[model samples]
Target: MGKLLFYIFCFLAFNSCIELNNPPNIQGTWELLSATTIRNDSSIVQDLENKRMIKIINQHHFAFLNHDNNNGKDTTAHFVAGGGAYSLVGNQYKESLEYCNFRDWEGHNFTFSVFIKGDTLIQEGIEEIEELGIEQKIIEKYTRVKVGRKRNIYATPLM
Candidate 1:
């Protein structure tokens, strides 16, 4: 019985030394609350009054969709969508965009500093595309979507 006790103690000691490096639990549906873009000579706050945007994040992949909330009634109606793989190390989040409706933005990687406070998530990062002549710092805020007993109309069907 002495040898069995020694083996058990050793197993417990080794298991205690092992650290599980699990990333933050960000897998869910999030809605964009606000977005601000800063350029060299201008800073613009995106007009979200008539727009709706949501992001869906899983274990290793993420997708986003944005469109006019009015169902394309206005002349300025727009729609955009993209999705790809992402990695998160602590507060540093990197997204590898593989598919986008805007072809020019595909295959680009964007790194952001992410902070989550309760139900709100804020991401700040610089976006630069040489071919597009765009270099801007963007800060985006999102709120986690809570699904209640009834089905949420905003929840998109995940394939």
Candidate 2:
């Protein structure tokens, strides 16, 4: 039965090697941690900032509310959009918006790194904000909850 055992091993290896870019399981709540804006030449800007909350309902829909962290007011904004796709292949995730209705925003694409350890999740990426004409790299941490937690859910990456 040595040959049979080898065949089974090969089968399992093949299935395990299948990498999905932007896997669907990431469809949940992700809170923002920290962000830094960079110029085209990779220079850090002192005044640029961003704080956000991202919610992915499914493979084709997601919502986001981002605000300036400088004000410290913790303002809330809403975005409703459809026809978007996301996937996590290896350690990188690509989030794309086919059409979004958040003030002259459409076809926006962003890439970030995702790490999952136990129930904690972390996402980091350089997100493009066309309205501000700048790109910012953000590091976000999160913890999974049952959706009934009495917290704002988007308060901090993990609450």
Candidate 3:
């Protein structure tokens, strides 16, 4: 009985240590490192190389923005932005779009498997952009960034 009690104590201690050493929180401003669209036919598309993207997540809502000022083409404006409330349940992250630059996307809901690896966040989901005319698997990798100045226009990192 004493040996069994000792073993249980050791196991509990080890598990508690793991729970205490949780990784960095995911609520922060993340700068887009790469955005890739993978199609069912095994083709890939890279569309944000020259664009600057910032993802901001607070306690209940999140926003994503792509700044295209460097492209020199103002199709509509200097940036394209989308935002809405979000819910996180286990590994399933869901977003209900309430605001978008394009009106067609106003009532859309999106689901993604969100994972934070080291200082980078990886999001994988199926996206059906109205203009694209097809459903594609979108994967975005972002790294944590700190905004230094107020005029930068990018979001500040979460506290």
Candidate 4:
């Protein structure tokens, strides 16, 4: 009886570390859930709130689509950055975006802590605001909707 109980305990412990929905390949494309921009005020709070959509082409590339429900205006911006990386641990994924020698923003690094469950991906990170040219971290959250099917970026161009 004691041996059986020990085995049960071990099984439960091992299974707890496994995520029910393993991280999806998530290599193709994804769309953003919201749109916000840093305010020019002292606090640098995000303002001009609007429902925004973003498409992540891959682990390295992404696009931001802005939507104004009040005015019915839509605009999209394509961005490509180098040295971005992603990793998965259990059900959690870590994504890093580096403004590596980019035009306006350089030497800027942003890290996100995310989790994948079922068909949803939730990411949370801190965005630093340069106040008086001083950097201060501000918390931000992002939800990405995985569309249709997961296609290999190498096989086809992400739309």
Best-performing candidate as measured by lDDT: 1
Give me the displacement of residue 69 in model 3, in angstroms.
Answer: 4.2
Q: Give the TM-score of candidate 3.
A: 0.69
The lDDT of each candidate is: 0.83, 0.58, 0.75, 0.45
C-alpha lDDT of residue 157 in model 1: 23
- Candidate 4: how many backbone clashes? 1
- List TM-scores for all candidates, in order: 0.78, 0.52, 0.69, 0.49
Better model by TM-score, 2 or 4?
2
Per residue, candidate 4 scores C-alpha lDDT tens digits across 12-99 of: 9788656444554555444443223343454443432444434453654433344443455445222334444556544445545443
| Per-candidate total of colliding backbone pairs | 0, 6, 0, 1
- Show where candidate 4 strays beyond 4 Å: 20-25, 34-50, 57-63, 67-104, 129-159
lDDT of 1: 0.83
Q: What are the C-alpha RMSDs, in order, of all predicted structures?
A: 8.1, 6.4, 6.0, 8.6
- Global lDDT of model 2: 0.58
Cα lDDT tens digits, model 3, 118-137, are 77788889877666475888
By TM-score, who's the top model here?
Answer: 1
| Candidate 1, superposed: residue stretches over 4 Å from native | 1-23, 149-159
In Å, residue 148's CA in model 4 sits off its true spot by 6.9
**92, model 3: CA deviation in Å?**
1.1
